[model samples]
Target: MSRYFPHPAYAEDQPLARTILITHVGTRAITTGTIIGAGIFGTREALRRLRKAAAPSTVTASRSQLYLRVAGHSTLWTIGIVSLGLAGRMWGREEIEWQDRSWRLMENEAQLQTDDWTYGGMVAGLAATALFKRPVGWVAAVGSVGAGSVAGTLGYLGWRYGLQRREPPISE
Candidate 1:
């Protein structure tokens, strides 16, 4: 993935600590993968359905570049751009301040949790969508993202909140 970073003098500081990049970059890669992996499988299923519905079924239609735009695959592309930004910020030397580092670390962990929940929901949604060996589309696809996110996000929030609010139990 290509990124555009201005001359060093123009920017204040880099996002990641230069020395600690190995761990953070790996985490960033895994987080981005989680996000992409969730959406890509569903997009594949969607493509199969669109193809099957085309005339002379079983004979595949020529793949169209614009099919992605028509079928809402651009969501993945947008997320890909965001992921690149996350990856690119690790390159420069200056480190984020302690306060900012704390905040960013918390945000990264929270996002990791959310990514897990969301990916699980995405899997279940894809499984539930297939009926008669064909995908159930339209509202169903949209609902997959929506309903799963709601339930999974709620569960994740509860777990994270509890962990943050209460101390670990002592084992005597």
Candidate 2:
């Protein structure tokens, strides 16, 4: 009997799907790591704040309040992680277009350079946000990350185009 579905080798050749899968996995991993790291670092302070603010009538009440706060925070983190994962998956589609159009290559010096800049920008933004605290800080942090990614993309495009222009034409 003939098979109804294409061979597994055909699926393996689809770079776009592979890129999206990798991006989704990477986003989830990063989000999970960040959530865990934050919990480990800030749980004590968070619990303390909850206790102080609630001024519960009894020990059990305070404990319950703490549990609620933790649960709420965990829920928020989970939502954020899922949102980021979805966004990453969507972004991967644009990346696949860039790859298909020869705008960027998966494993190349230009791509590496662009990634470095993008990550550096994100780190810098997050650091600024953490240091400044609230209101203006969050906005600035987001702006910085956006600016950084745009700058990196533009730089990569310029480099690619410049290299192309500099190449000598082949003689027939």
Candidate 3:
């Protein structure tokens, strides 16, 4: 019975699993858009305020500082967003968890953990440069998080639905 749907255990539910992955991919795209939107709509004023008191500082600092600060801020923003979704563990708090299965939830939880690790690692790299008064290591951190997701999804779909094309058998 459980095989018919996405079981909440360690297993592949295929279609449903793909749906879940696509949902995340969609969600990430939306979040990236939102972050950019929010920043575009309301960052100048905030930066202005932050810079009013800091000398050798303007609304837009050097590229290196800008990268470190904004990237760091983005990391914090991600953490807050993730925390909001984690309000529900066993009881009921987070709304999204309403439909998420336990294993799926765990997998997502692990994913968040990995993201945090990545963000923190980048922070460390940036911090090291900052300590030496150098620039943020953006070059080393190329590629967005969504890149792998979209690729993985496309590959999964191709493997699942495209690799085994059917054709009529030759006449005997």
Runs in model 3 lying further than 4 Å from the true structure: 1-61, 88-90, 93-102, 105-172
Q: Write down the RMSD of candidate 2 (Cα, Å).
A: 15.0
Error of 2 at 71 (Å): 33
Q: Which lDDT tens digits does candidate 2 get at residues 103-169?
A: 2233334444555554554465445435433333333334434334444445555665765554323
Q: For each candidate, what TM-score against the reference?
A: 0.33, 0.30, 0.31
Can you write out model 3's per-residue Cα lDDT over 57-121, one digit (the tens) per residue?
44444543554455445544554565455433325534333445433533453344333443444
Ranking by TM-score: 1, 3, 2
lDDT of 2: 0.44
In candidate 3, how many Å is residue 43 off?
A: 6.4
Better of 2 and 3 by lDDT: 2
lDDT of each: 0.44, 0.44, 0.42
Worst ten-residue run, lDDT, model 2?
A: 1-10
Model 3 lowest lDDT segment of ten: 140-149
Model 1 TM-score relative to the real fold: 0.33
lDDT, candidate 1, 1-172, per-residue tens: 0011111321234433332334334333433443444466467668868888544456332232122222233334434565567557644523544224433433454555655675565566545445324443453444444334445656777777765664334444
* Candidate 3 residue-wise lDDT at 129: 57
* Model 2: CA > 4 A from native: 1-104, 137-140, 148-172
